[model samples]
Target: MDGAGSGVWNDGSVHVDDQVGQGVSADLAAFLRNADDDRPVKIVSSVCGECGGRVFVVLVDDVEGGAERVCTGCGGRAFIADSAEFWGEADPGEAGCPCGGGEFETAVTFSLAADGPVRWVTVGLRCEQDGLCGIYVDWKIDYGPTDHLLALA
Candidate 1:
């Protein structure tokens, strides 16, 4: 495990390495703040740069509040806004029983701030009560998936 409070941002958003989502989401904030070593969780992000390169953040835990993602590859940048949306879900096949016989899922949506060619990314954290899980974060260049790009910043 990375460190208890070390994984969460002071502004409430969870921080992963250059690739993880800070546990700022609503449902996972509390869980993230109080999570232990065995129960590890982090936010991820998908970013598309202006130069046509993709920075697929497998885990984003190093970013602090107000900081954006800068395309190390193309000079593209992403800034973390004052706030982001965080949602979670508990389903039967997701959060399994403690007996290691069932499976359960928990998801978290990390909404990044909009800027330049990269608008925002929604990342999900899925897991089983038994601690089995997966993570996904896809970047949306515009507000709408089909929306147009306004600038090249």
Candidate 2:
């Protein structure tokens, strides 16, 4: 991907390529590009388990130590604490826009294997106060039929 803030990282097992400022679709492309590789991957659901709604309002407050994905249809919620380790070891502890906003609007993308299991997951965050965008977290999933993993998102 040729873009101002595009980059690719390959560590022999995992390959991540992303472009900043290109929106969620681009981020999803980055994750999908490596889906067929032999490396393990993970996924987060867009479908709400409660009402099967695909729409969600995501919120993340790193400083306050909270994050969640709320389904708009049934007001169902999935919390970060529910899948803490699935979020990986990295923390967006002080991550914020230059405008100093701590809140963010979140979007998630998943990479799936040809066999229907998820291979990877990417979480993209945009500053709710200033419109700044960047990736927040991403991790590979080694275990799943994907149903359990989807419910976690």
Backbone clashes for every candidate come to: 28, 5
**Highest TM-score against the true fold, candidate:** 2
How well is each residue in 1-153 modelled by candidate 1, as lDDT tens digits? 332222444443333321233222344334433342222233332243466433312223323212233343565544322112211221112222335523222223333332222244333332333443333233433344422222111
Q: How close is candidate 1 to the true structure, as a TM-score?
A: 0.25
Q: How many Å off is the CA of 26 in candidate 2?
A: 10
**Using Cα atoms with residue i matched to residue i, what is each candidate's TM-score against the true structure?**
0.25, 0.46
RMSD of each: 16.7, 8.7
In the range 4-118, model 2's lDDT, one tens digit per residue, is: 2334434443534321222333434343434434533332324556887654456554432334666667888775433454335334343456787755445454556666676
Which candidate comes out best when scored by lDDT? 2
The C-alpha stretches of model 1 lying farther than 4 A from their native spots are: 1-103, 114-118, 144-153
Clashes of 1: 28
